[model samples]
Target: MKFLHSADWQLGKPFGRFDPDVRGALTEARFDAIDALGRAAAEHGAQHVIVAGDIFDTEGPEDRTIVQAISRMDRHACSWWLLPGNHDFARNGGLWDRVRQRAGDKIAILSEPEPRELEEQIWLLPAPLIHRHNLEDPTTLFEAMETPGARLRIGIAHGSIRDFGSSGETKNQIAPDRARLSNLDYLALGDWHGTLKVDARTWYSGTPETDRFQRDEPGGALVVEVHPDIAPTVTPIRTGRFQWLNRDWTVNDKAAFDAECDELLAKVDAPNTLLQLSLAGITSLGDRVAMLARLENDLGHRLRHLAVRPDDLVGRPREEDLAALSVEGMLGTAATKLNAKIDAGGPDGVIAKRALERLFVEYSREEQA
Candidate 1:
């Protein structure tokens, strides 16, 4: 039996960090991912698509959001098994009920811990969330749940595989050897927001669309195929409209930095890419100023979003840069004090560096005028 394993759709996410136009595009892309999953299912000849959890960004979404999701899923002929996640936990007459109202027979809400027959000799054991956070492991019940003639037992759940000593991993901690403990053929997981392989039989499908800046191979679904007594074959299929990338670079020269930026632009289709580039190392104040201008004026426009981190990127003032700021005037006097502060090197050095850059920029503008 073959099926698509996916999770963290997070439909109706406001994406409030972005502007109205970009936010709209991001929210729309999530709905579009449903169609992508449908197409992938068709291409793979898979009839069932199991979304482990988090179909919605919140438990109570707008009616229009609910309608949009149902309509898109209805377009596909195959079955879509959606399990409740932390964001959209199960309850009496809640979001899932509203979904059930609009959803066709093809849409199966796995809001309860039950084993449903997928096909001949195949069974899917879904452990759906009832609350936003659970103290006990959701998949613990899969151990006792029995399915008659269940040749392929695929457990679907939403939680962490282990406590990584992090605050985020505190809730919904599932055992690392859950697949083995449950005696299942495969285990599909969610809540990690990144594609991961827990063991030979367990895997996290990640989000179908890229959302956050952390690059964890976010844009994909795991197409899983299982046999009676064999390991499941999991293939990651990319299905994201936008790419969120984070990169770090160091600048020692202006021309080299420009060349590096050129290389990046050439490699990435900037129109569909969002990047947060953190720059470090040191360069001349003039070159640093020039690079900042190019990044803001030229590079920023090319990409969907460009966030430059210039905290560690120091701009050592050159004689020419100081000359441009004026050698014997009020501007020069202020520049000298700022330069002294920079040389002293303390908490105030950070502020002085920025002031020096602004002073140079404004003076250069006046000089040009």
Candidate 2:
């Protein structure tokens, strides 16, 4: 049987960290990826699409958000199974019921621990979450669930796979060998936003849309093909519109840093890129100021979002830099005192760094005027 395994849609995420325009684009991309996923299912001739968990960013999503999601899922034109996740847990609210009302027969909610016979020779055992955070493993029941001897048993769940050291593994841990213990043909998991293969029979499809820049491969779905007594063939298909990047660089000189920045810009398509940069090592205070000016003026306008970690970026002012400022007398005495504080490292050293940068800025602006 040919099926599509995807999860962690996280639809309706607010993207509050970005500005209004960027936030809209990011939230819209998640919905856009749903259509892309549908197109992938059609291309692969998938009979079923199983979204392991976290269909929505939260249970309290706006009604319009829920309606739009259902409409997108309906466009797939295949049987789509959505299991409840921590974010959209099976609560007392009418969120699931509202979805059922709009979804009709094309979308099915696997909100139980029952073995559903999806096809004549295929069965699906889903362990849907009832609460956001459960101390017990949600897949524990899958180990004892029974299916017909001739059917291909598939387990669907949303949690961390054990021994993986995932950030939330300790809270919602699932045995890494659950597939072997449960005698299943394949196990599809979620919660970790990265494409991973835990074992021959277990895999995570990751989020269809990239959310963070944690260095793991995201933004894809797994097209799985299972036979009665053979291992499933899993193929990852990319379906994200935006590119997320986290880059780290160490700069010893201004020229090298500028070249690296130019190369990064050349490689990424700015309109669809979100980049986070971590800079380390030392540079002259003048060069540091120039680099930041470029980031705020030239580079910031090119990308959707740009974040820089400058804590490790130490600024060492050269004698020429201080001399160029040309504030002799009382102001010069202040500069001399600040420079001394910088030489002797302390809280005063940090203040001196900021004070010197402001002085440089003031002098530079005056020169330009």
Candidate 3:
């Protein structure tokens, strides 16, 4: 049996940290991931798409979110199996109930632990979450869960495997060796937001689209092919529209800095890239101003989002930096005072250094004008 494995759709995620427009774009991208997944299913010849868990970001999602998800799932020819995870656990007359009412016959909400037969000899053992956190392993019953004597059994579940997602706490933990214990051909998992392999037959499918900045890179879906008495084949297929990237660079001079900047810009698809760039090492204040200006004017305008940290990219004020301020005017006077305060070293020095850098940036902008 060949299927597309995905999870953590988080349909109504607000993304409050970003500006309203950026937040809307990111939110829409999550939906776009669904369309991408549908195409991928057709392309990969997947008969089913099993999302391990966390289909919604919260238990109480808007009707619009539920409607939108179901509508998209209906577009694909393949059947979609959605399981409730920690974020949206199964509750009586809750989110799952509403989804069921509107969802087409093709969509199945695996809100129970019943064994569902996808085909004549293919079985899906879903250990859907009933509570937000279950002390006992949800898949524990798989050992005794009955199926025909010679059939392919697949287990789908959510939660961490031995403290996989907490601060040394095993909340909703799954046994590391559950697949072997359950006599399953494949075990599909969720909660971890990056695709991962846990043993030969078990895997965490991760989120189809990434939401956080620090998650494992290259978020996408997985394609799995399995049969009884044979090892399952799992392949990752990218279905995300945006790229969340983090980069660190060390700078000592303008040439090296410019080279690095050019290289980075050349590598990324700017409109789809959200970059968080941090810099370290010492460079002259003049070059620092240039670096920041280029980052703001060039990269910032092109990239979907840009966050820069220049704190450790310390600026040592040079003669030309001071010379540009005109050594005899109010600009020069303010620069001298701020520079002196920086030398004195205190909370005031930090403020002075920031002010001086701003002065350089403003002056450079005006000079260009």
Can you write out model 1's per-residue Cα lDDT over 86-205, one digit (the tens) per residue?
999999989999998888889999998989988877888999999888999999999999888878899999988876454242288899899999999999998877788998899989
- lDDT sort, best first: 1, 3, 2
lDDT of 2 by residue, 206-290 (tens): 8899988765343999999988778899999998878889988888668878998899888877888888988887888878878
**Candidate 1 has which clashing residue pairs, if any?**
none
**Candidate 1 at 234: error in angstroms?**
0.9
lDDT of 3 by residue, 88-134 (tens): 99999998999988988889999989888888878899998888889
Superposed on all Cα atoms, the candidates' RMSDs to the truth, in angstroms, are 1.7, 1.9, 2.5
lDDT of each: 0.88, 0.84, 0.86
Name every residue pair that clashes in candidate 2: none
Best by lDDT: 1
Count steric clashes of candidate 2.
0
Candidate 1 local lDDT, residue 123 = 87
Worst 10 residues of 3 by lDDT: 162-171
